[model samples]
Target: MKKSLVAALAVFSLVNAEQISIGGTSFERVDALKAYEVGCASNDADACFEAGWIHYQRQNLNKAIELYTRACNANNYKACTNLGALYFSGEGVKVDIKKAKELFSKACELGDGDGCNNTAFLYEQKKDIKTALKLYKKACDLGHQIACGAYKELSK
Candidate 1:
């Protein structure tokens, strides 16, 4: 993680946005990204996720990674899964399967179906079919559509 991201998070942690608010704030649909950025700067995990997603759409992968790292550190499962996807696919950063597995495992621990499914895929790649099957079952139970199919295929 970059020092800048950590520094921003540390600073945000010291102050609450609402405590410093002077007047009413309106978050228009068109300005949603701006609102998310403000909220993220205030250390809101969901806002960090929204901001990261916006950055990702804009092809600002470094910014997205920083914000996603913040959100993931805050125990936001979606952010963990997305961060793992980035590492797994080598989109903006170098491919690191171990890091991706670790992040996906964290997301799975937080009850994300996508995370469970992804973890299972990695396990399958390593030829650990039993573990993969178990993870696939868990993911399937959690409503990961692809995991359901994978589980059935592996069961045969």
Candidate 2:
């Protein structure tokens, strides 16, 4: 039994080594992604956010949602924004307008500009112009240049 266990451990190590070696082909980005994944698994919100970004880049929206959810749950503002976006866009999950609003509010409360911008857009679509304007202003104040431009265009 001990010998078998030792053999299993060796196999596991070998697998890990091969995985790492494969990553070494694009070492900088791959290593960074691995580190972020590990950090996310270890309950680091920022790391979870980073891992979500990696998944997003790979167009793995479901995986991105999973990591973003973890980060949002851990109080990462950007992650909250991302989660709101996922709900709003119906990319990784079904559209839940109310849930998207809630997540956007959470991100906005945490001072995420992107969240404010997205929330504003949602409000605008609903014809809640006043609320949309307010959120757009907030996003602009937060230095989200795109929001500022959008608000300007819409106000005209």
lDDT of 2 by residue, 28-98 (tens): 44555666676666677887887798789789998899999999998899999988888987988999999
Question: What alpha-carbon RMSD in Å does predicted model 1 have with respect to the real structure?
Answer: 8.2
State model 1's lDDT.
Answer: 0.83
CA deviation > 4 Å runs, candidate 1 = 1-30
In model 1, what lDDT does residue 25 have?
32
Q: So what's the TM-score on candidate 2?
A: 0.75
How many angstroms is residue 21 displaced in model 1 relative to the true structure, after the best TM-score fit?
24
Q: What number of clashing residue pairs does each candidate have, in the order they appear?
A: 0, 0
Provide the lDDT at 54 for model 1. Answer: 75
lDDT of 1 by residue, 33-139 (tens): 55567778778788789779878977999999999999999999999999999999999999999999999999998999999999999999999999999999999
TM-scores for candidates 1 onward, in order: 0.80, 0.75
